[model samples]
Target chain A: MPVPDDRKQQPKTTADAKIPGAYEGETVTRRRFMTASAHTAGGIATAAFTLPALGMAFGPVFEKEQVRWEAVGPTEDFPDDTYIPRTITLSPGIGEVGKSTVYVRRYNDTIDSEVKDEYNDYVAITSRCMHLGCPVRYVEASERFICPCHGGVYDREGKVSGGPPVRPLDRFYTRVRDGIVEVGPRYSLNSELRRFSPRDPGQAIDGVGQYLYPSRPSIRKLPGT
Target chain B: MAKLPTTSGTRPRGTRAETTEAPATAPQRNKLQETGVSTIDWLDERTSLSAGARWMMFRKIPKGTNWFYTLGSATMFAFLSQAVTGVFLAMYYDPSATRAYESVRFLTNEVFLGEFVRGMHKWGSTVMVILIFLHMARTFFFGAYKYPRELNWVIGVVLLILTLAMSFTGYLLPFDQRSYWATTVGVAINGTGPLVGPYLSDFLRAGPEFGATTLARFYAIHMLLLPGIIAAMIGAHLYLVARLGTTAPPWIRAESSPELREDSK
Candidate 1:
C-alpha cells in the first residue's frame, strides 16, 4: 500500500473538514452556534439581576453624607474651662440609637493653640472613642474622657492621653448661629488636632495612616474648616 | 447506579414489590399507592432522575466508617434548623434601628413560640459552628484532605468563613446595647487592615459610622446575601462529596483481595 499521508494540513473551514450539513467556506456549525448563544444568554440573565442588587447594597458608600446643624444650647451653657455633655442626633429616624453624646465647651484661647479659625470659637468633642466607636464618658474630676470597652483615655483637648486610642476623639464642627451653639457633622483629627474628613473609630490619621486609611467620600468636614 | 441489585420487578422504590422481591407477576396495589407510584413513574420517565437519586444515595463507604462521619450531616441539619428559625424570626423582625430592639422584644416576649424559635436560631448558630469545626477536624486528622480531595477542603474553608460572616452579621440584628457595642468593636477590628481596612468597615456599615441604614444592611446580608451564597456552596460541596466517596480513617489499613495480592507478587 502507498504510504498514508502523514503531513499535517489545517482545515481551512468547517465545510472543508466535512462537518455535518456544512456549506462551502463556512467556518461555523449550527450546534456550536446554539451552545454559544445559550451560554451568552445565561450569563446576561445572571448579570442583569446581580449588578443591580450589588449596587443597591453598596450605594451608600458613594453617596454624599447629609449636613445638619443641631443647636446644643445657648453660648453660656458651655463654659470655657470644662466640658458639658450634650446629646445630639446623628441619624434622625432612629429613636435612641441615633443619639450620641458630645462634650462641648467654649474654645479656650490660652490652651487651644491651633490657629483660631472661624469654626473653632466653640470647641465640641465627640465622645466616640478613637480605639473603637464605643461612647466615652467625660470624667468631671479627671477632666478626661474614658472608654469602657477598652481603656481609651482622651485629655481635655480631645487628644489621646492613654491606652489603645489610635488618635484623638472625633469632633463636630461648632458654629454659633442665632446666639445658639450648633454642632455640625463630625470630623476626625490626628494626634496634632489636624482636621481630616470624618473616619470611623480605630483609624489613625497620623503619618502613613493618613494615606493607608484615606478619608471616605460620604462624610467630610465643612469646606473652609 | 448501574442497578440496585434487587430481585424485585423493576418497579421503583417505596413499593410492596421492592420489599418482597416479587416475581414479574406483580401484586395488587391500593389506589393511594397506585397514584403515588404512577406519579413518580411519570416524573422518572420524563427526567430519568431516579438514576441520579440512586447514584447520590447508594454510595459505598470504606470498611471502618464510624460515628465521626456523621458530623457533616449534623452540621447540614444544623444549618437547616438555622434557616428555618431565621425565616420565622424575620416575620416579626423590623430591621430599622428605631424598631429593631422593640421588634426583638416583642418577638421574645409576646409572639407565641417566638422565644423558643428565636432561642433555636440563636443557639443553633453556635451548634452549627461547633459541628462544622468538628467535621473539619475529622477531615484534617484523617488526612482526607490529600490529593483529589484538596478542592473539597478549599470549599469547606469557604463555607466556614461564610458561616462566621453569618454570625457577625446576625449578632447585630437584636439592636440591643450589647449587640450594638459588639458590632462596633467588630467593625473596628475589621478596620485595622492595612490599606483596605477603612473601606471594608465603610462597606460593612454602609458608611463611615454606624448610620441609619447599618442595621438594615446587616439584616440583608445576614438573611439574603450570605445565606444564598452559602446554600449554593453547600450544594456544590455535597455534589463533590457524593461524586468522590469518603476516605477511611487513617487507622484503618488498606486490605487487598487475596487474588490481587497473589497477582502482584
Candidate 2:
C-alpha cells in the first residue's frame, strides 16, 4: 500500500519545526551533530560493556564436545550378550577426570548393517538410572537393570520396562579397535529407543514420543541412532 | 574533630527551634553535630539528596501497617545475603558437569568459610521463599492487590516466579546424583508443556540432554539472568509501592471510614 502524502511529509515537517531557517542542503546544526555524536557514544558504550561479558558468559556453550576414547578393556574379555559393569574415566570438557560406571555388553556379530564400524557390536549403558540418577544394578535373575531409588527397571536392551523412568537408561558411545573395547562420550537414549531392540539404532524421538519423553538439551547429537 | 554528641536520644541537635533561638549559651552547638548537618546540607544543596532521602524514609504509612510490612524488607535482605554468598561461591564453582560436583566438594572441605557461605546461600534462599510467600499472603489478606496497586501485585508474582527459577537452576549447580536426576525430571516436565514445551526444555538444557551445556546454561541463568530480572522487577515493585502507598488492613479501613467521611465533608 502506498503511504499517504501527508504521512510521508511528516519527517519534513518535524525537520522544518526543528530548524525553521534551514533547507535540506544546509550544513548540519550543532544540536543535530551533538545528538548524532551522543547516539554513537551510547552505542559504543553499550557494545563495550555487553560484548565481552556475553562472550565470557557463553564461551563454554560454543565449545566442541570434548571427547576422548578411554579403553574399557579387551573385547575378548567380555563374553557375548552379557552385561559387564566397568568404570570409565570421563573428562567432560572440564579439566577434571570423573569416574562413572557403564554396563558394557558385547554382541557376537554386527548389531546394525548400516553403520559399518566394528565397534557397533558393543553397547555401553550408563549405570545412572533414568528416573533419579541413582545407580541401577543389574538383576541377573530378573534380566533387568533395577534402580534402588524408585524401582525403575530397564530391560537388557536398556529400555524402561517398569516403574517411574520416563525414558530408557542413558548410553555411551562405544568403539572396538584392534581387539580392545573403548568408550567415548555418554549420550541419552532417544525416545524411539525407549522400547528399542538390540539390533535397532533407535529412532530420534518425534511426534508422540517428543511429547512423552522430551529430549534433554544435549551438547552432542544422539550417538547410536 | 569535635566531640560526638553524647546523648543517643531521638533529639537531633539541629532542630529548627534550637537553630533559631540559640539560647544564651547553647553548649557551642556540639561541633560534631554542626559538621554532620553542614555535610548533609552541602550534599542537599548540590544534589537535593535530602528530598530523595525524605521521600524514601519519611512516608506516612497507614496506622495499620504493622510488623507484617517488614516481610518485604526481610525478603530483600535474604536476596542480598544470597547474592553476596553466591558471588563467593562463584569464585570457586566450575559450571561443568565434570568439575561441578568435585568443585563443590572442594569448597566444602577445603576453602575457608566456603561451607558456611554455601550454607548461608542455601538457607537464605529458603528464607527468601518463606518471606516472599508471607509477604504475598499479607498483601492478599489486606486486599492490597486491588485497583491502583494491581500492577505492583503482578510484579510481585513475577518476582516470586523468578525467585523460584533461581532456586531451581541453582539446585543443579551442585551436580550431585540428586541434582542431576531432579534436573532430568525438571527438564522432562518442561517438555510436557504444549507447543513450545520440548523446545523450551531443549533451549534451557541447551540441546537434547543435560550435560556440560546444560550446566553452563543453568549457571548463567541462576547467577546472571534471573538475578538481573529480579533486580529490575524489584525496582519496579518498589517504585509502584512508593507511588501507590501500602494498603491499610481492611478492618482498619472499615473502622476509619467514619473519620474519612467526616474529613471529606
State every prediction's TM-score relative to the real structure: 0.87, 0.72
Model 2 agreement with the true structure over B28-60: per-residue lDDT tens digits = 676656667767665565687767777778788
Q: For candidate 2, lDDT tens digit of each residue in A1-225?
A: 987677444344434657766656546766787999999999999999999987765454344545578898998777656689998765444432246688887754433222324444677888877664567898878879998877888887777789877667777677888988988766655445432211111222435654444333334543554
lDDT of 2: 0.71
Off by over 4 Å in 2: A1-19, A24-41, A44-68, A93-98, A108-119, A132-134, A184-206, A211-225, B1-29, B84-118, B172-228, B253-265
Candidate 1 lDDT at B229 equals 95
Candidate 1 lDDT by residue in tens digits, B63-151: 89999999999999999999999999999999998888999999999999999999999999999999999999999999989988899
Count clashing residue pairs per candidate: 0, 8
Each prediction's whole-model lDDT (CA): 0.87, 0.71
In the range A25-67, model 1's lDDT, one tens digit per residue, is 8877888889999999999999999999889777877878789
Model 1: CAPRI class: medium
In order, what DockQ does each candidate have?
A: 0.63, 0.21
